[model samples]
Target: MISLNMLSLSLILFSISAAVFLLRRNMFIMLMALELGLNSAGMAAAHFALTNSQTEPVIWALLFFAIAAAEAAIGLALLIMISRKFSTLNSDEIKELKG
Candidate 1:
């Protein structure tokens, strides 16, 4: 049986993620919120997989991990390049070629 508690927890997580994504003006905060949303999705997939005795949830979790890793790598690279060129990491202050 699908539990109400699980559903409520999922809803709460999604709500928090949405709020963080909307409320945060900083690029780093937004990235963190995006990660939270992806993690909650992985959690839901794993829960469903456990209940069904299927392997799909684990696969989904692995996919999420891969995606997170790629995202982190790209984001960190971008931040480094930006800081090197602009001398700042603030999203609001990044300029393309005005340095």
Candidate 2:
């Protein structure tokens, strides 16, 4: 059914998140990976809602979607601050204590 494909797509998205978060040294890319993981989780919840023929899961997914949006906004704000302070988006370079 459609739910099955959605679940499979969620799994693939999580895998992509893992790879991007682990392999990339850029902070923006890492933030994108985090968003991907969040989206995949939302998709999985939607899949469950569809399979169960219920509205509660769908509502919960909507709430999660809102939270994800807020998280993205906060994350982008932080990204701006970090880039301004560190002058670089590289994860390794951003770690230095510039005292």
Candidate 3:
């Protein structure tokens, strides 16, 4: 019923995000796609937990969201640094990343 629809939507979201991640060359777009994929996974977990009358999976989903948030923050920071250094966000353009 509604659960099936939600799961379908989550699957669609994951699919779209994966496609965008694979096809896009811009670092920002890739980061956004990665975030979309992570959020879709969390959404699916929460929906599954709710349908099954379970609390643990929901908690795990929430933790997953927190991790996603932290990842986005760090990713953006790195992206900004890279953009500043190279003056571009295209992954293909930035050849050498020396530390």
Candidate 4:
């Protein structure tokens, strides 16, 4: 019932985030889309854990969230540095990164 709805919503969010991540060239937008994708995965995991009466999935989901947070922090820091150095948020314009 509710689990199905949660899973459906999670799938929708994941799809949207994936599309945003793939289609957008801005570093900040990509970072946000990545975060949204990770969060949606965590949400699905948590929902499944609750439906199955299991603790392990919930713990894994929490760990996923922590990892996502760290990723977001590092991503933002890199984005800031990149923007400072390149003066642009568009990933396509940063050709100096290719090596």
> Which candidate ranks first by TM-score, i.e. highest?
4
Each prediction's RMSD to truth:
3.4, 2.2, 1.9, 1.1
* TM match of model 4 to true structure: 0.94
Name the regions of candidate 4 deviating beyond 4 angstroms.
none
Error of 1 at 84 (Å): 3.8
* Residue-level lDDT tens digits of model 3 in 76-99: 999999999999999999989668
- Indicate the TM-score of model 3: 0.93
Candidate 1 structure quality by residue, lDDT tens digits, 1-99: 464455566678878998998987676777778888887777777777767789987899899989988888898788677678878656668656574
- Return model 3's CA RMSD, one decimal: 1.9
The number of clashing residue pairs in each candidate reads 0, 0, 0, 0
Candidates, ranked, TM-score: 4, 3, 2, 1
Q: After superposition, how far is residue 73 of candidate 2 from its true place, in Å?
A: 1.0
Query: Distance from true position, residue 16, model 4, in Å?
Result: 0.6
Question: What is the alpha-carbon lDDT of model 3 when measured against the actual structure?
Answer: 0.92
Candidate 4 C-alpha RMSD relative to the actual structure = 1.1
lDDT of each: 0.77, 0.90, 0.92, 0.92
Candidate 2 C-alpha lDDT tens digits along 36-79:
98889889889999999988888878887898899899999999
Off by over 4 Å in 2: 97-99
Candidate 1 Cα errors over 4 Å, as ranges:
1-4, 87-99
